[model samples]
Target: MVGAGALIGLAVEFHALGWSSIPGNSCGGRYRPCPEGTTPTLILAFVFTFAGFTGLTVALAAFRRIRPGKALPGALAAAGVLIALWPGWQAHLWLRGPVLDPAWQASPDRPASVRGVGVWALGDGAGTVVRARTDALIAYDSATGDRGWVLRAPARESVCAMSERPVDGIGLVAFARDEEPCDTVWGVEVSSGRTVWERDFAGRTLLYGGGGVLSADGGVAVALGERSVHGYGLTDGAVRWTAKPTAARAEGGDDAECEPVTASSAGGTTRVVVTCGRYTDFHSAWLLTLDDATGKEPSRRELPVESWVNAAAVLSAEPFTLLVQEKDERGLAAVLAYAEPDDPERRPVTIPLTADEEDLALTGLHPVFTARPVFRAQVADGNLIVAAARPGSDDAERVAAYSLDDGRRRWHADLGTPVVALAPAGPGRVAVLGESQRLWTLTTGEGTRVGEEDGTTVRDIAFKIDDGPQLVRAGDGWVIVNADGDTYAPALAVRP
Candidate 1:
């Protein structure tokens, strides 16, 4: 019975340490861990005490039967040894020193309840991207930080949603916004910051979801949703075509919907990747490639169950179609690039994630304790810049950058907090956000802290963006020193 109790105690310790055979599987049960607010230290102490008491009681019983003198001393010594080591172990678990600098540790001036509004900054000091209110868009000059132009929504129409930052197009910044009765998509000239043209869907179901309006190199913009795809001219906002989503139904079963995950257009081809699942079971995924000129889907390929793409980017370097396959129950996720999306015979080049990144992704139960993988691929100069983190560790998580051209590791920066958001700064740089309400800028070429040394460069964030969370380049160089607190103010936007 003493041996059995020792085995049980060993099992409990192993489980708490996350030493299970299955990676990312904690012993606290998958999909559910120990309930919120359950103190691990208290529970561990209780188990160890109980185990020691039981062993001592057994030894006493044996001593009375066999008349052994040494049993009491041995059991007492064992208990003392365990109690002595408890403090050291607890210190190791709890004493991970602070990740923020004392200089940058000031409290946020903005209220905690404020919601982030849409903000985007342009390249080469192009301009400041701003949305003062939910129904209006404003652009400020990079030199002056003064409003360059403002486009207000009609009284009857409200801006329902926004796309990912300002997409650089042919002499224009293409953005999408869905209104009350219609969805409005526009291409505003960057130089003027005024809408060049606007397209609206009167009362039709607006295409909303991943990559709201993506600019194709061939002067086209595409929007994707679960049930439909819409394309428009980048210059005129003229409707090119609307087509049924390219998701197939499960044979002899109920209808399954295709939810658009991410999309891109490269080499005159627009690929919309969609995940097909019924209810909560995401069973399959595929990609639909359309010709830029006609908006006609030239090809459709159903991905293997093992290669369900979760995120995608059409990299400027080599025009590689980068796909992110998230870690699943079976295996760790991989980032792969293909010369062609439809060619099954063509092999793909895999981009590596930081070790234990899968576990970081699985930590979504608590935002502070978990990290969603950051897989943004952007073309700065001529290389594809990708950002990701290994956040399971508490002391500090590592945020890294890799060049897609040669699969070479460029740089990595150890961050004190789990990553909450990531955005491109400028050439060879990316901005990282943490739930601790802090932001840091790191170089892509070598993950060195780019701004002030000694962590003073890190800036305090007021709160996470509500509805539309976005990060953009700020200041003259690569350092993202500030967020647009004016736009994200509590009075300007309502908390959802």
Candidate 2:
């Protein structure tokens, strides 16, 4: 019985520590591990104590029967005590925090949040980039902090919006005159800062707009206007096409009342969501598909809009996911993931985001579905990849990926501190940057730890970002960007 209890305790402890013959076979239930929580500690302590007492009682019973003594039981108890007091991991470098001064730092008032709007980091290649109102676009050498190039906004006009990602090294930036709409757009070569093409249109967006303003790939650069979808040449900024979206099934007066809210483009596949209703009131929403290169509309599906849904935003385009929001609040209602391009026979999978405050919430970069493109979460390996963390803090506990089709979690790895930024490393791998300034890489296929570089930069440099942050790897060094904050201590730091 004593041995049996000990074996049971061992089994539970091993399982909790992620022991499994298979990668994810009934181990780590729910993937929410409170490694230092009091509950698990208390349970193991009680089991060991009970098992020790049972062994002592057996020894006494044997003593009265024959010749058994307390030697064996006493040695066992002392051994257990020693094991309980032992500290697990040694802290060598963490005890003395290492700090490295930045090679160059941006000013306190570099590109900042304007009129309560969010700031975004773009141009993910071998350079560091930031866009401000006056400095329409700026690129810096990652190691030297030298200004590579800057495109100033036109007089009396501010740079309003930019592309979510650069297409073949070209990025689009829009300028608005005074308080007028961001009508005039320009496609520029990001590396050289040369204007490739310029055009103007009736550029308007949702009333409550946010980041993820534009997305481009292949020959198409998509921008959602007030009621229409506009597609342009990604490299030349030439007008491709413009068309109004028709609902797959009309639920209101007609499709004319509908407004194109969110648009996402990846690998020649583009997705657009349109919401039809009166001012600020919900009626219905439509999920429309288009060829990213040609802007030809193929299929449109009317989403199963519930009363609790305030709006819908596409989290990823490759696998096609719609993030349903709680009505007039910051909570999430459900996540609807559509079928992949290759596998169209699979049914759409709908899963609800956790209402439980104790669990990690799926964090989106921006809440609104306007010209602004969402950059926080992405799709990889038929799953949506994003940072998930418990509420009430800026820190994220893990980076998790869930299958958009079946709603099954593919894998998750513990992020010891808040994840400030992350980007694709190479094929099948992602690089994650934590608030502690640590940088590491993990396999997107299995979520395995590929390698890690214990960061020497100070942890305080990271931001408690409400908006998204970004990590840019340039040459052999890295640039950590905290565009979410306005303060100047460590807004943008380059480490070589």
Candidate 3:
């Protein structure tokens, strides 16, 4: 049964990715055979067929083994017939087609659009928001469901990543390379959808940390790679400075393949932090920080635990940065708070996490569970907000705020379903999206459901404009793309 199920699973994946091609010249080449691409209907049909056949085969085999009589043979034959007819039933539903009502239009004040995954929108009032799609930068009007303006590149160049930065009264849309050996950058105006300036870099695959295209201080735009760091002028995309570390300096005695995890900028300079093993074994972890402006020799410090640091985030406005450390065999997890660069020698505040009955007993008071948690944590308003779900419970999700001053649970919100995205909207407020695809506004003490709509999956990271969260909806919903290159959503405003 396991083997049959595995085969069926592979078939479903192949069909969804559209790996199966049709045979030549059949039914005017219009009716393609086999998997039929990534359309949801075709994928659903294939999954149902596979599941039905697997169950039928298992049932028939089980009956034959148990009885081995004339009735057993007849039962197996009947099962085969039923399995064969299952696809026809599915086809009937498919051919009957989707029931779309023209009367189902979005409210005149709340229009929506379907942007790709991870697209971020910065709100500008009057239903207008600056949004980043997979290949273009667009201005979306949520009220009328219209795209006010769009800036798209030619076919030769692909947009790797985009960041919307508002400087003065103008919105700066920055476009960078999507692939390696990349060197082009373009900035467009949000109001008129016209190109402001374009610059070409001499490097490849520029990494944008923290503050979109410009640094937090608006002095330099920095990009980091495996072995080099480049800083461009924020006003114009001209090269301000470039730093290429030596192979030994970049690797720090560990394997040369391990790249540094870049840190977000603070004050006026951006920092790149790399962890390396002390010896060849990759056991000891060392933290190295480099300045974005000069990229000179880094200040290195050794951590206490000899384990890999999987993820780290910089906590702004606070005196220290929070680091998530995962250690082996010891079965331990630690959150280390390190002081700022000026006081590098100060000992970090280490909060050790362990798995024990006593530890679980400490629940809302002390740290519990040593296993590396799969949730994301950030500091909002002077409080540490962690979004985690209860173990082994699919529907149990909680967002807890821990006071930085005393390490106590200040407030906790039970989000009901699994939280898919969490972003800091402002001080004391967070924008959350659940697995149900519903949007919620969560604060320290309360969570309010803002809206729920079908056919929309929340992006992994959501952006907050002045008004609310910006979302993209597709699949089984109304998609309106006009000749002016506008995609509008009339279905989002529909109440259940």
Candidate 4:
């Protein structure tokens, strides 16, 4: 009975993981072909796993060929070991990392004038691919090339920027009114294209871009106004908390000079970065962390240098890091890391993103001017992983990892070709797609190849693949989204 239950559980797990070697499997009610597998090896593994522990033990005990106590102990140990190691074996031997042959392709269905700036795959099941254009946000079914929904900007208005990511299935967006930069915020549901709520900040306060949110729990929609930070309800857009710098200023310099520029949030804390100095050229900045529920300031830290020519951006809020820019809009200057979050005593360590070696210019970051904070580099595996380009070029040709503790270059892998984008994959690993239509995975710490031997390359595609694409794991496969301001490239492609 124990052996049978274990076998049944293993089968269920394999089915749940989409490892079943069936061609016409019901893949989200769409015609996605089941992934190719090692059928012969799978059969051998199954037979050995079952008979080695269960069948052999039964035969040995029933025929009195061996003692029941010894046979039973050996059988249980073998079964436990096999069950524990099963998942890893399947991940390595059966799945064999990512395959580039897409089950379906979604090309750019817009006019020649329309250009895509970003693409995101939201949700886990079945999944939907969202393409962000200057005009509207379009959702497409990943399994089939059908339109899920369209959330267009108001008449005479256009989409200016979007939130860093969708939170609790709601993606916050910013739109410009006529000639304005970004004056309104809208929360749109990811699965359904319903606008849950909208807030227009025109006459009341100044607006820059999208809402900064921590999580979905008792959610708060936080935004950085001209000089203050406002937290609204995530679902209803109701004002929950608001913190003005003058009222909550620390025992430091003048609070009048501090102007909120950009903000990001993670783990129930919203961090707002404000530049403080004269109007012409700011000298310093302050990073204030506010609780999501109450607008209470928990931790406040001072940044050394910030000016009109040199600016700072909140890169990742979870780990709490900042990117200082050389030019106002473009060029890498340095990266600052907060060793701890919400710890008042913690000081930031400044790390340079661009090295003098000319081999590590970051190409994965959004220009420093956008209202939306969409930083492509990620903090994973105890290091900051960033896509790099050679000096004097903008294409990402290498990936490098720097130590988060002391800001030292640990390792860098020369991809030989430009990379598409970086996406968080399994633990300690980030998925990388080559501009040549191939996919691979690398360990963020050691920068070792954990994917295929030579990586999986997708062939026979009829669309233009750009250098900046997001690699997303949607449902049973992967989705390659092209949003790098390419006017001619396909919006996205789905891997089976």
Q: Count of backbone clashes for each model? A: 1, 7, 5, 0
Per-residue alpha-carbon lDDT of candidate 3 for residues 1-496, written as tens digits (9 for 90 to 100):
3334443444453453332222221211111212222255456557755774677588558866877766655544555454544554455334323222221323322113323212333343223444444355556554444557766754545444343234432333333433454445555555677776676655334333222222223555555444455666555666777655432434455343333444445554554445454334454444445455565545656556556554443444244554444436463354455545544586665544322211110111111111011124556654666565455443436666655555555666665665554555444556554544334556643333333212122221111111112323222222221211123331231111
| Cα lDDT computed for each candidate against the true fold | 0.47, 0.58, 0.43, 0.62
Tell me, by TM-score, which candidate is best.
4
**Candidate 4 residue-wise lDDT, 59-83, digit = tens:** 4466455453565655654575466
Clashing pairs in 2: 211-372, 211-373, 212-372, 212-373, 213-371, 213-372, 213-373
Q: Give me the displacement of residue 242 in model 3, in angstroms.
A: 1.8
Tens digits of per-residue lDDT for model 2, 184-244: 7788887688888887887774334433446787778887666777888877677888867
Ranking by lDDT: 4, 2, 1, 3
Q: TM-scores across all candidates?
A: 0.54, 0.67, 0.52, 0.71
lDDT of 1 at 390: 51
- Stretches of candidate 2 above 4 Å error? 1-101, 110-125, 128-135, 177-180, 208-212, 248-255, 292-294, 307-313, 326-332, 341-346, 355-376, 391-395, 452-467, 484-486, 489-496
Error in Å for residue 405 of model 4:
1.3
lDDT, residue 137, model 1? 56
Least accurate 10 contiguous residues by lDDT in model 2:
86-95
